[model samples]
Target: MTETYDIILRNGRVMDPETGLDRVCDVAISAHKIARVGHFEGSAAREIDATGLIVAPGFLDLHAHGQSVAADRMQAFDGVTTTLELEVGALPVAGWYERQATLPRALNYGTAAAWIFARKVAFGAIELDADVHPIDQMGAGSEDMCWSTEAADSQQTDEIVSLVRQGLDEGAIGIGLPNGYAPGAGVKEMADICDLAFQYGTPTFTHIAYLSNIDPKSSVDSYVRLIGLAGATGAHMHICHLNSTSLMDIERVVELVSKAQEQNLPITTEAYPYGTGATVVSAGFFMEPDFVRRTGSNYSNIELIRNHHRFTGREDMRRAREASPTDLVMWHFLDVDANDEHRRLLDLSVTYPGGSIASDAMPWINEDGSIYEGLEWPLPDQLSAHPRSSGTFTRFLREHVRERRTMSLMDALAKCTILPGKVIESCAPQIAKKVRLQEGCDADIVVFDLETVTDRAEFNAMNRPSEGVRQLLVNGQFVIVDGELETGAAPGQPIRREMP
Candidate 1:
């Protein structure tokens, strides 16, 4: 009798980004790994007929912030197999990991050492709370902006570095430097963190310190600082959310990064296929007096997600921020749908050579201004969140690969899979088994129809999930089948580095 695999995905157009393989084939899964990939005459307890579907390695999201069961469900529709919190990660990394281990999850998850949270703790501003996610900490410094705008004294800097090192030692995949949130962090502080990362031979996921189109501490200056740190410390510097941060000056900044890459500096970039971005309304940069002028956006561009309220002036925005500093707001940096120039600027970042695609997805919140952490299926339609949380990956495939045809499907898949996996594999060895469809690799895969796959969630109706994922498997367990989510499935596993 032939050996029967656990599950078999047969007769699908199997596309492996790493091998450039795009042909009809069968993929066998057993023991949470790919057992075989070819015309294998194998029997399986469950077989998914994937005719006319694209079978590929599930996407790796290196910047996801939505870390709950609700967020995982939405991301599953977007074809994400692994979602990591690497931009602004968790503090007390061990506690964070411990907390996650106890919860049932749908997709694989991991976090980096959070620099912002370390500074908050070192500065004696807030207590470490494993339940309060890093996203909630964004505006927690609103009372004085101390964590966001105060330079750490030598003693405090030392303490901060020590905290970050502890997180890494506790198996954080990398370091999350949300420098933009704490612009007050001097060059020396950044260098110290980068040096620690170098010692560990890990990457520093960074949101550069500034975000303006012009000089005198502009986005260009920030990129220069990040690149300098990588060159000086010999650490990998991963730039997060390149599109929204660069705004209209993407061409100039991309040029600078390109030149740095040419010189072989350790740098990588990621961008979501959107013109707008979402963050706390009271973020550090929004408080700048020249914020509207620098970003070429006004108060009207910032809309509170809970109620769709747009501020009319600085005072209006300030009042809202002061009332509820942690409220999520949509910042429309570019009118991509209305302006051709804005669309092109966005394309520059999204389609950059060798760049990866990341969602930077936010968490789900109820209309009453509380986080929706309930384990509910078919998430409440009244819940609010950035559309990108549910649509990012599919949107990229729809616009770039199917609609525009600006790039081939294989290259696009690389952005979603292999490129992201390569970004952190140097530090997180477990990722080596992911992002591939060949034998011996982890069976983290997705099947979808190219023609019908599209993002249904928009700004007006943000709760709708994307529509293309036919089947999704994480660790060889089906979380989604026949375009439906398996509500009871809890197959997620932690993707962390081994502790010493």
Candidate 2:
């Protein structure tokens, strides 16, 4: 007698970080959940011959900023099944979620309530644009600049808190605090935000308040304040992109996070694999006169992503910053040396045993500041932007796991999948049912050839898709099959923290 399943993956090397299961096996799925994870006499409506492939939970990105169709396709080719804008989250969380729900995407999606946008709205800095993503709308013009440099008054603080609560009530996963971009947000304001997270039983995803490796208030000082807030309010805190933020001081920053965890503080951190970091020219870090000295990068090392024009001098940098404050600029912090410190630092973040990996992906905007729309797969050659947006996870597996052997494949897989799932599950319990290959888990899975997996996207030619991702599924629906995308599949569902 044979049982039936919606789909059966036969003879694949199944890997589950949660249960330490790593062996060649068969997995059966029914409806949209895993039904069995071992050999079984079963017939299926659809069967995948996943022989010689690594069958693991689909990858989840916690810091993706490109929340559009074009971005989704790029991520799908790289094997990402779910992506969330947790670093610089959306404003008016309901509107963001509603708009996304109406669209067809290649992967599951969600976002946090953006604290920076709330402050912008309260201060009347800039009117929120319905069409643009919240992070793109920020720091674009003179009015938006105030959201970063001007401190909020008491009334404004209250308004910000109210907006955050409204977002939570509307099912936001957590609170996104990109404090580094908004230097004017005072300690009280930040603490109040964390307090709100504590009150609502959610986490706060933060880009630390400072990025300087050294100064009056360095990354160390920033971690102290953030960790202190978590200790005081009992709010879970997630630090974003530690590699770029910590620079030469990554070891110290990691130590601080370790001590906090030792004291049982609910704190976690993530980092991208790249050495160079990108951000808007108008960010507060560029406002400082000694910014170059502090970050150890000069004008020559900075290049505009739109035109690939390198900044020649102080005046050129100033002119560019003033001319287009919102344009993306790349900082070559890791180019100073080649002794593998940058690689080592990145390895430390993924190998920390408690930290997760995030891409901090930026969108591929055209020269006229527009993103491509529609359900086209393998985006056209015209799309160009940060390589990390397309290749972070693939590069991590290729360079760290396969090439360097710094971490086992199973360990690295956990960093990208189950670890981030656990972090989100802390705030949204629904996520606990996702991001694993066990029975009763959501059938979001990836099948890939281990030996040939690698990233092809580079800074010069940025939008290239990866190689060796054979298939990808979201909620048991195939988004990519036989190394090609299944166009027009909108099976991606919203992962939210519905209020109890």
Candidate 3:
């Protein structure tokens, strides 16, 4: 293996859940796959002498917003290898692919077939952008979601479906439903595309509406509806940030889901480990008067991020509220706690006996950089973005498993590795054990300087990169080395499904 191996990472605690091996070993890599994973005497072109460190399969970000070059840079340093961006903002799949030609990336790219946002752009209507019905529990909060665009004729619907089909062809793993908007999709459109996904054998990722801190109805209903959609269409459906919706009732939610699964709902989920949910405040609770009933405050108290108005005084707040009903406002709502009423939301996710974590991260920039205008003055992002952005893995190792002694290290790591890998493989078969590391897998691996590893981003101290993800390899290319991004090693490509 050494003779033909191109690179070898020697002497490290390798944790590969798929292989069920956790011990000190040397990993030999050749031709973009793991050549051997045992004691090695390798003479390779490049060698990382990983003595006393973690040599694990590289982590994949299930959903990321690495749209800009800078955001991609941050993700590499943060320990993300292959990322699928579902925030299908303004660009269609084809245009997004073309734009990637302009940036040098450190990981494999995948997309979501964006129905909601794309329709918003296709039709000049705002209501269609918000998927919530006017009578929904979260209807008042619909201002933040992409509403349904004006009703498209059958021809228009066909064209939109064609665009989504194009996205699937271009390597979009599946459909993305910001279901809070797009109620017009109802059961009909959902069945159509879900059937398409089932035919394609892909997944549909959902951020369901009425799935929030304050739904009088059971959030379990949202899960049931999604399960029904999956049952009807036969598409695998993934719920984003499931723990958030589960709130303090992990047992209840988990029990319901398990029962639904027993009934064959084809539903599954992933969550960020942090206690607090991260979203533009206005999007989730602010604009919703009903949410005001749930969260206890309206737009007046919601923290603003990148408010261009300077949102100087009380007058600015009143005027801006008058101007844009749907301005983007990022808010960090929950404080650190173990057993506060809503605080249990934080508890259930990380401590859940069997749950996976992800960083529901957005690109972090200065108040001016990321925010759209008049939206809301942004929060000073010491750690305003979700903690999972940088802290998900580390929090598990340091705080939960290692420090508190709640979970064993193996279980903690399993949540990070094999569980997510299985889910992604099931969701994105094209990239499956192929582009990522699984056997005949692309040698996308990460060798950690576990001794010094730490997540530096705090609620107020964001923009600080994680320390000691010493070496990162994406498809056998060295993107991070010795501690930082290696200059000029951008070999990532835009993955496509099969064009519509």
* RMSD of candidates 1 onward, in order: 0.9, 1.6, 5.8
- Per residue, candidate 2 scores C-alpha lDDT tens digits across 1-500 of 78999999999999998899999999999999999999889989999999999999999899998888778888887779888998788778888988898778778899998888888888787665556776466655543467777778899999999988888888888999889888778988888999999988888999888777786778888899899999988999998987888877888888989999999998988888888888776676776788778777777888888888998877787787778766788887775247577767756665676678888888877775455564555677766678988888888899879888888999999998889988878668767777888999999998999898888998888988888899888899988898888887778889898578
> Each candidate's TM vs. the true structure?
0.99, 0.97, 0.82
Residues 1-500 of candidate 1 have per-residue lDDT tens digits of 68899999989999999998899999999999999998978799999999999999999999999899999999999999999999999988888989888878999999999989899888777788888877787668678778788889999999999999999998898999989989999889999999999889889999989988777889989999899999999889999999998878899999999999999999999999998899998887887889878878888998999999988988888898899988999998999999999999999999999999999999999987667889888899899999999999999999999999989999999999999999999889888788998899999999999998999999999889999899999999999999999998889999886666
For all candidates in order, the CA lDDT equals 0.92, 0.83, 0.60
Each candidate's clash count: 0, 0, 42
TM-score of 3: 0.82
Which candidate has the highest TM-score of all?
Answer: 1
Q: Sort by lDDT, best first.
A: 1, 2, 3
- Provide the global lDDT of candidate 2 against the true structure: 0.83
Candidate 1: Cα lDDT at 148? 80
Task: Report the lDDT tens digits of candidate 3 across residue range 82-175.
Answer: 6666533223555566666656765777677776654553453333222221111112333334435234556656656776776677666677
CA lDDT for candidate 3? 0.60
Give the better candidate number (1 or 2) by TM-score. 1
In model 2, pairs of residues that clash are: none
Stretches of candidate 1 exceeding 4 Å from the true structure: none
